[model samples]
Target chain A: MATIKVLAKCCGVSVATVSNILNNKPGASAKTRKLVLEMAEQLNYTPNIVAKNLKMQKTRSIGVIAEDMTIFSIPDIIDGITDYCQKQEYQILLTNLRLFKKYNDTYYNKDDYYELVRQEIKKLMEKQVEGIIYVAAHERVIRCIPDNLPIPAVMAYGYSKSRKIPSVVVDDVGGAAGIVKYLLDQGHKKVGVITGKTDSLHAQARLIGYQQVLYQNKILYDPGLVAEGDWTRESGYRCAGELLEKGVSAIFAMNDLMAGGVYDRVEELKQTIGEEISVAGYDDRELSGYYHPPLTTVSLPLHDIGYKASEWMIELLNGGELENAGENVCAVDCMLLIRKSVKDIT
Target chain B: MATIKVLAKCCGVSVATVSNILNNKPGASAKTRKLVLEMAEQLNYTPNIVAKNLKMQKTRSIGVIAEDMTIFSIPDIIDGITDYCQKQEYQILLTNLRLFKKYNDTYYNKDDYYELVRQEIKKLMEKQVEGIIYVAAHERVIRCIPDNLPIPAVMAYGYSKSRKIPSVVVDDVGGAAGIVKYLLDQGHKKVGVITGKTDSLHAQARLIGYQQVLYQNKILYDPGLVAEGDWTRESGYRCAGELLEKGVSAIFAMNDLMAGGVYDRVEELKQTIGEEISVAGYDDRELSGYYHPPLTTVSLPLHDIGYKASEWMIELLNGGELENAGENVCAVDCMLLIRKSVKDIT
Candidate 1:
């Protein structure tokens, strides 16, 4: 059967008008609404009442706001959100803000790009989206949110500085501390920790967690064991190789991609993971499970974070007071996936 | 000055209503419209005409449709799309069809995952998204696309059976072949290939490219020299180690993650990567440059692929025919990133 979409196009009306008429909503001119019905009838458009109810008070939509859409964590978080929303009959409206880098300073700039994005958001808003989920790619608190939105806003993966919204985040500090403690518990006295960009707030928290864990365990924090990576695999390989040559028994690589690199270089030096030297990684991406020795890594609950973020947004939209003074701070726990990569150094 | 958003909220009317009273759109009831106008003055919500014009009929958004959100490619392509779109004042609306899976009778079941995916797509249609970009976690054609969509759609990191929908894909075959050919040119007779998933279209293409390049140059294809991996660094390490036991002189990993794994295993075996067995990888992820002795890889031009996909979707939306019918393929060239991974066998 032809869909209402075809009917809308044939009659030259927005799908919204066709939906309003089909669902018997209050808006829509009688003339235009009559044309939609006629076209739908001729095309045999089957109206889905289940979808109609889901659409009611909802654009049947949600938005994911993120910087750097390509980060590994995004997909899992999105997967979690999508799975939950779809079960509830909701569609997602994705917004890639790409605010990680400066635009005008780069190569291309076009007016159509700006105009089109604004139009899409306005379109979603006009459809009266029930809730909006902001999926930030990093840990930066956004200060430039558009005030044009009328629906409830929520953050996932990253959050805002203001408490006016709710957010879901991984316990970066707790997760990092767990990794460090894992290394120490395995009896690796000299543990090395690689970090992402020092300026990153999440990275900073991880670093603190690593240090605190070591200090509490009675192991003096060694500056020699600290190195930095750009969150790239090569950086992990290089930094870990440099540290490995110094004879550290266990290594903690931040994020799995970098851990992959460290794993590569460690093997290159004739060291067997979990045998000659123990190694651990973070952000248990799916690929991590397949990595050799299957990378003993930390599993960040990305999907749970996204799901919780959306759930919180729904609550906030309904006028519920989220914790942190209407600013929901959701800290999803991270699990350590023990593969063959770590050794019992004790 | 107060924004129109705050003023409209305070006046208990819609932003569109206030905008209508300001822009003089024809359809508002006179009394309510008058109240909106007077309230805007009292609340000092002097409309920023420039911002308003920017917003007028503009959603400042684009929509992204991905197969699985967590794949390695989607986020990067999104990073590129967002980088470009954000600069143009466009935001991205992200949606994932969650369609990448081995289709079977289970998939066709009404409550099945794939069917649920179609239901989600129907919901995205109701949101009135102006355009859509499809991204896959891996490079290949997806089997779960719904029969119809109401907006312009483009595919990235994947292709469509119908040429009407434009797509952007990397030349995995060519890129993999190029790396193998480089090993051949280096005087290595026993070259091994560490492949990704055996059923993956991209993996099959790379194998074809490897065989084509090797046979054309008069080298024999050995089944013993080929190993299959699911494209993880650990798999690479295992596969490479297996190939090493068989005494292959060089290896070509399907992607960078696998290549890194090969390097790790080689080090563990006390065999140097570049000095003993030459290694190469596809997809010049950031770490390829910083790897010890660096790494030799093929560039996938991910961001470019995303940008071009958007451009193609716009063209299709405007009713333009694809440049070629038989060759509707847009294969991005792979640039050889020569690093320390490969060595001269002669």
Candidate 2:
């Protein structure tokens, strides 16, 4: 409850010196800064952000509207957003729509959900949030944010498809190419692909990555090697059976869940994952590490996407030019997690 | 941005009528109310909650300090908090202290981390949040929240151990007892137990639950059958081998990750789970469903804990008495998810 003057007097320093330390301005000596901060902590001094922000018309707060918190990718992304915001000393006003809990995976395509989002945005705007970040559960071209929004908006893990509202998403094409290249490097000539829903942006981009790697390696592209999956374990199992029967030396299931399915099918066929047929997966989910031989997969840069989105949101708030890797969309790269699943045939 | 007056004028209604409808008060004709609301929405009218709240000296916002968003338990708990807050028309000012990311698992016992929590709470208080809700990553006796806080503080998934601060935690004892009782009812006389780290409150409570069920069934408790596991899959595997060798018909691993280890050992020994050995798990994690025959586990009421914490926090804000199911603690019950992992040996 102590003011700057009281904290400074208690610490035997000038009020300006104490102010510099509290504001993290680089004017105070290290020893003096430590003394002032420790004293401030002891006195329970908290700057009234609400009163200050009201006068300045700057809340130093970002409104983060997550599609669903319970989803696998959302937490990590939110973590990234928080990490960035913490460094900037900005607080987040979180609006969890709980879409999955209410609609059970069917809410993503619903027009009514947009109305819910609009209402949340208005509520946040009423609270004087400087900007908004819409965190989607997955990658998709979701046009949820209205074009005429007063504040700057950034989309994480989904495309806004507008120049004004930038998007930060995973580089699925590059990630898929890297895994397929790794499989090819392991002396596998025939590598079968098990994809997520064909209409999915992730699936399409990953397929392109696969094709790019094959092209660079001077291998002819075979559409027959590709199997359509609805991003389910059962679908992966069915696809794995067909791929194995076709005599492919290795298989690449788009996600970790599907890779798990491939493992199940391989086990039923009385063959080990790494020995009989090399396998790879995408999305380094926690369960992937528990997979028998473990899964060689790509770890989605979900956190980076969130961080990037925050960066863009703040940049826009400050009237800075938006930095985008491609046409106002930033594609964060995924990391390759090498485990025991991929066999070195050569 | 149309004001209430402008909206009312556009809808051919009085300002009082518009204000009443907006505040959810009755007496206005349904048709007139619909016209006013629709006109308001079309004009992108947003209420200035900040200015109004400043006058009332009450912000309909709760400060949610999550230990770590990336942790499995955190997102669902936050979701529950957000769900309750949304219903109450309250917003959450989130401060995710990336404890796990910063200090890994060791941060739980660090005294310095308490300072970080205190700082965050002070910041939230400065922002004029009505109350504070601390969401822990896992259940532990975390004494991070200050004993003498200005605002009401509620602990979710952890014990605050303060009479003033109501703690909402999972009913580990009851959850453990329910699973053990199910195993006994299925004719498994020789049951084995794999416990988490001995010092954990959850592990200790669960052990007591196991003892209670055995006493209720008039079955003699065997100390030798209880194997110690550090809540790791490797520990689970090691304990499973020891318990199976001790001639136990069924094993209950304290967590799903440990239960997966039980399955690993069973497979290695060429014995099938749910048939040769009826296995059960606690913490019905998502990965449990992907287990060979899936897992019959106790689903921790993580969301329920968040919901209960929010209820108590808001109740306190409204000048209501603290309602704790136990002494300063409310233990939410865990749901038993019936899956194929548990078999009917009778």
Candidate 3:
């Protein structure tokens, strides 16, 4: 309940001096600053942030609208954003759309989704957020960016079709290629692939990476070696069974969950992972390291992407242009985590 | 940039009329209100929230400081909180502490943790958040609540030891007891227990519930049937193997993840899950229903707890007392989700 006037009176200093010391503004002597701070602490003076924000015409806050909070990967990305914001002395206004529930609802449509997102954006704007960050739960393209938002906007884990707005995304194609090249270098000639939905951009890109590696190595691109999965453990289990029937020496599941399913199937067949057959996965999730024999996987640098996205938004807010940032899209590199899942055939 | 003055001039009305219509104050005429709204929409008038907040002396914003974001359950709790806040017309300022990383660091101690939390609380207070909701990633007792916080603080999924502040927590003991009674009524006498760390309060509470059910059923309590796990799938697998050696007819793992491990071990032993051994787990996590036999588990009502916590905080913010809320702790009941994991063993 103590105000600056009370603290100033208690410290035997003028109110302006106390205010300068509290706000870290110039004109307060070091001795005055020390005395004021000590007295303020003693009196438990709380600064009036609402008045300060009004005077500054900015809240020192940004809004983050996440597509869904339940997705496993989204939290880590948020963690990265929070870390950056904390260090930069900015707060976050978060809105979780719970898009999964909306997507599952029969009555929900694209128009409704857009309307809901626009409402959230308007709400944040009304709160005087300096910038906005849209985070996608999955790796996909966002077709719309709400043309002409007054505040600077950045996209994380997804991109806009027009590429006018800045975005930070994972280099899925490069990551897949790196993993396949590692496998091929280890002499995995008959490597089978368990892919996610064929329609997915990430799945297509990963498949392309697989084929590129095989083409460069002069190995025959066998359509029979690829099996489709819908990114579930059951699908991976079934798909791995089909792949094993073809007598493939090694396998690559597009995700760690599918890789886990493949591990289960291999164990069921009395085969030891990393010994009788080699396996690798993507998205080095928490369970990947604990999987039997652990998992050789590619780590999606989602946290880095989130951090970079926040940095870019802050830059944009400070009147800096993002035009030189190469196509308005920054692709963060993925890390190859070489665990015990993959064996060296040589 | 369109202010109420511009809208008032365009609408041929006074600035007070425009302001009343905008704020939904009762003084504006119905005709003037309609005209002002139409002209405001046509002019794309966006209210200056900073100025409005300064005038009202309240921001209508709440701060949610999550202990850690990466924990699976925390997001759901946040989702619940967001849902309620949205309905109540409140905005949220979120801060994820990433305490898991700090907890794992050898240099981090209790003092550092408290100081970090205190700083976050100060940050939120400085932003003039009307109320504060401190969300813990896990269910545990918070030793300190930082005495004399300016804003009303509520604990979600955790409680302060002093009980001066209101908290919403899951009834873990009641949940465990309910599940055990359900199993016992199905004629299962020898129910093996896979518990978390013995030091955990939840683990101890669940064990007590198990013993209470056994005592009520006139069955002898056997320490040999209980196996210790560290709340991980690996630990569950190892502990289930030990429990199976004791020839128990049914098993109850402390969590769905551990139950999943038990299912895998059961399948590895060439035994049917629901028929050969009935299984039940707690915390009906996403993957529990997708497990081979579809785990029958107790659902922790985290969302309800979050909703209740927010409602209580809002009540306190409205100058309503939570005096009737016994010991400032509201324990929400957990529901038992009946699934295929538990067989009716008559």
Most DockQ-accurate candidate:
2
lDDT by residue (A224-339, candidate 3, tens digit) is: 99999988888889999999999988899999889988988997899999998889999987667767788999999988988999999999988987856669988789999999
* TM of each candidate vs. truth: 0.71, 0.91, 0.92
- Write down the TM-score for model 2: 0.91
Q: Could you give candidate 1's per-residue lDDT for residues B1-346 as a string of tens digits?
A: 4777887888788888877888888878989887887887676454442243223533444567766666566677777676656556554656665555334323333356656555545544444345667776767665555536555667788877665566678887788888888889999999888999998887898999999998989988899999998888779988987898899989899888898888888877877879987889987776566555678988887888887776666566557777764666688776888888888876
Give the winner by TM-score.
Answer: 3
Report lDDT (Cα) of residue B338, candidate 3.
95
Error of 2 at B231 (Å): 0.7
DockQ of each: 0.29, 0.65, 0.64
For model 3, how many clashes?
0
Q: Rate residue B320 of model 1 by lDDT.
A: 77
Error of 1 at A285 (Å): 6.4
A-chain TM-score, model 2: 0.88
lDDT of 1: 0.72
- In candidate 3, what are the lDDT values of residues B1-346, reduced to their tens digit? 6777888899998998888888889997788889899999998788888778868888888999898887777888888888789888888899998888777732134678888888888888878899899898777788556757778999999877765678888888889999999999888889999999988878988999899989988999999999999888878889889999999888999998888789879878999889998899999886676566678999989778878889998999999889666689888899999999788878
Error of 3 at A145 (Å): 3.0
